[model samples]
Target: LHQFDPQDVNYNMPSVLQVSGPLDVKRVEDVFCQLIARHATLRTRFELIDSEPMQWIEDTVPFAVEYTKVQAAGTTADTDQDTTTDTYTRVNIEAQQLVSRFVRPFDLQAAPLLRVGLVDLGVQEVEQEAQHLLMLDMHHIVSDGVSLEVLTDEFVRLYDGEELAPLRIQYKDYAVWQQSEAHQEWMQRQEAYWLNTFQGELPVLDLSTDFARPAVQSTAGDTIEFALGREVSERLKELAAQTGATLYMVLLAAYTTLLHKYTGQEDIVVGTPIAGRPHAELESLVGVFINTLAMRNYPSSDKSFLD
Candidate 1:
């Protein structure tokens, strides 16, 4: 056995989860610096997240994150979450590139915060407003959607002047634990389900593209999204009631059926993004807890979307 390699393979990419109202750039910068100091993982850089063969910019001090000056510009949003807008361009060149280029590069943390421009609303919205932008050029190794929760929470705790607690463990250990308990039960059930359902058939898909040979493994790299309005959405939900299944499960079934019709496959395997939130303590930490599972669809002869 080759014991020379420290065991970690997955890496996280820098992502801007959301855009907030404009804030004091200085304060926002302070918050990030403090967060990094506390979370050594954030401070320490690997050419990747694990002890990978890469460069990690351990210190990002003297970092100045730019903030747009929003005037609020006399706008009212119906939802409390929504803020009025007067637009201007914001850019985080390096930060943006980091997400797209999921590989190593020089000066990783350049342009750390992806920008969402600001507006002026005079005293109504801009006053006493420490509108801040939370910028994290987190390496994929250290930040995943689930672990991000942890990172954000710790940041808030430290900012609020609370004594920050150390993490129960590191990201590396979690990866090892994940592979250990392989939940063979789930695997066996899924395998049996597929083997019986499509013993003599193929996957069902009506995809117009290269269904015979997909161009890429990850559709995330190129997923074209569409929105459904409330009326159609409600209609689908109502129809989904017949299966006594969730809207998501029902939708996947329908999609699988369509794919089978198109591809002439009786059994289907779908790639699904699952949030690996198995642990409660890791909730507030920012790391990669996102795992992908191939969902097997073994549809019987009778079920339809409406059914």
Candidate 2:
């Protein structure tokens, strides 16, 4: 935000929830609204006042869940022109259009940076089978991945006609607590540790690349996935036990070791996310409660892998 404009309209978080079953549209809408009303963060918007930012919570946010029908393959009439093929092609085209809108940036000033859409999977009034695709688009400023899981759980419970207990405090209450004098003092106490940890000139990681690096950073990216075999996974567990450390710690040590071998830089700092919700009451709340902690590793050449 310090480097870019606040209203750039390029920052957004999107997720899709695929649900297959009997879908009650009215019930789902009511439960969705209840979910937003129960959580203050969902109904929050940011604004600049006196050159500072402040959160504005709306009493009610607009219901923006759109419903569209997607024709099922082999369900169309058997005409000479093959109506089923035509229907399938049309549905695929419409679905792509919906996906394009799903990634569009949201307006931060608009309260409730959430929009939902339901895609009917050939469910008609006379048909017995019912299913839907729940599309969700939200701004990262107001939420994170954890928020998505919380909402999904609540929606399922509400759809099952179960009552949810009222929250004692909301995210706004936490924000207010952060401004207290005691909190400021607590925050200051950690300054010395961070300062000492990052002392001296930071080393730049010169990664070996196949192509020239760009002058400006870009969000355009993709992910690759790989999995360790069962035997290797069990060995990793055994290694963690011998070292008296957790699996995560052992894996992190291995990662830092790999980086040290690749870049020949032992003073490595790796960033990992931690859930900032320390209180049990805040666990079920839907909000962005995460902080990144930099883990500095200085592996010695004399020590073994367990070290």
Candidate 3:
């Protein structure tokens, strides 16, 4: 009980990759999957063990990694032989795969969360051309925004022969512990606090999202992503350090300020995903231990983005 640092969890979304280069795609994929399967949480699902969602782990999945490889319309170049593939891509819609519903495991499985598709770049003959493509798709449930970075780093380390350390806990334990930690008292307090803060605010943002969809349409919305560069991100970290506040607080403040300016509302409420993991054991597991809630902030004309 001296110190317990748990891993963060993420929502269930299909995380995808499009790799184009003059390389040995199959071998690269094989190595990638092998690295992921070594982690325990990636092999687990969630179960309510003792009134909490814990990692309901299995010995292994039938196919630890699901490979979806599609051949391109050209001669395949040898993979691992890095050739430039700096190309813009177009989007095509297809039916979402059922694997989406499977509880996403972390990279610690007997095999990585593997899916492969051979992309058809359709590049017909050219000079300065030695290009091939390999695409890997992973369910985002196992890959949090931060965990993406971790996965990349770990992948590189594995390829570079860096020795890996064994993780102490899996996602299954985290699931159960989370529920236990969120006892009636905590929920009551959280409800009271959130209720007071958000009760009187108007809606924020101009995204115009809908909470409901027709019965046939499963999901109601999509997402847009943008990142803050090092300079701004570091400034935020500095502010948080000085004020002894969390990044969550700062982000909430920024959203509030943005809303007040955009909506001309003094009080604004916005919803964000919160980690539902409360117990120490839950820190390491993967599952849907997240929820959305509205936050309220006051109106201010001069509130800067960083304020």
Candidate 4:
């Protein structure tokens, strides 16, 4: 998807960590280099070989941390009183801008599709210590949510000078196994299941939108964050347990109900991600191992929630 549409930034995953107190820039840089050395996915790049995309891992890749010093936007008249406030506001704005810049499309052909930036906010009056922001930008082709968590845990351990256990297999090993003859039967069974499930004409979801649908699908969208209060959350979990269904199933059922209410359609299809790691060995590895599962449901007014 990225190779065809190089302008899309949806696949870019950027995260920021706030660091207080004195920071060792050299040590941070060395930690990132060590992480890249440890994960084959960090050193892997894709290229077109015989009209097909093929990924190859390099023995090593050069890594660097881009550093920026944040200063107050302009001089304030009340230097003593407002200096600290002004400096903090400037740091926040710069941090936002830095994150915006970091969330950008990556060149798939480039090795090690990960980059880091460090923003240095000079010593603060309250903490009396320097502040820094560590920004990490990675392409989704080589990572997912689990991979991020794995990277963070390993980063902390490596930074603390703790030794990590050697990995028995890398992502490339999984890829090779997936294409091997031994896995053919399992793959064929899965393929057949999906083919049989959607054998006929698929229904198109036509929920009302504020604006007319565009000619081409867009990857652009905004996120709305909300929290279901603790009471409601616990009730939902209880309901899931009572019904012998997982919390995800209960939530998915409610979601489909809402969609049915809006569209007045009985049949609905939703896509959800599943961690594709089927083996314990693949759990701690950092790579893209997520698969989308299309769930089809039928909602009816007469049927109860349990049905």
Candidate number with greatest lDDT: 4
- At residue 194, candidate 4 shows an lDDT of 90
Global lDDT of model 3:
0.50
| Candidate 1: tens digits of C-alpha lDDT, residues 1-307 | 0123232222324434443444444555566766655554555444444645653445454444434333332324452433322211122333344334432332434323122222222233333333323344445545666656666676566656687766676555565565564755666876898678656555545556845555645424555899999998997898678657789977787787777777666567888889877777656555567778767776555665444
lDDT on C-alpha atoms for all candidate structures: 0.52, 0.79, 0.50, 0.86
Evaluated at residue 198, the lDDT of candidate 2 is 91
| Residue pairs in candidate 2 whose N, alpha carbon or C atoms collide under 3 angstroms | none
Our model 4 lands, by Cα RMSD against the true structure, at: 2.5
How close to the true structure is residue 37 of candidate 3, measured as C-alpha lDDT?
66
Model 4 agreement with the true structure over 54-105: per-residue lDDT tens digits: 8989998878899888763333445565666766676788778977886777
- Per-residue lDDT of 117-184 in model 3, one digit per residue for the tens? 44334342333333333334444545454444445566657655676676666554554454785665
* lDDT of the structure predicted as candidate 2: 0.79
Please report how far candidate 4 places residue 173 from its true position, in Å.
0.7
The residue pairs in collision within model 4 are: none
Better of 3 and 4 by TM-score: 4
Number of the candidate with higher lDDT, 1 or 2: 2
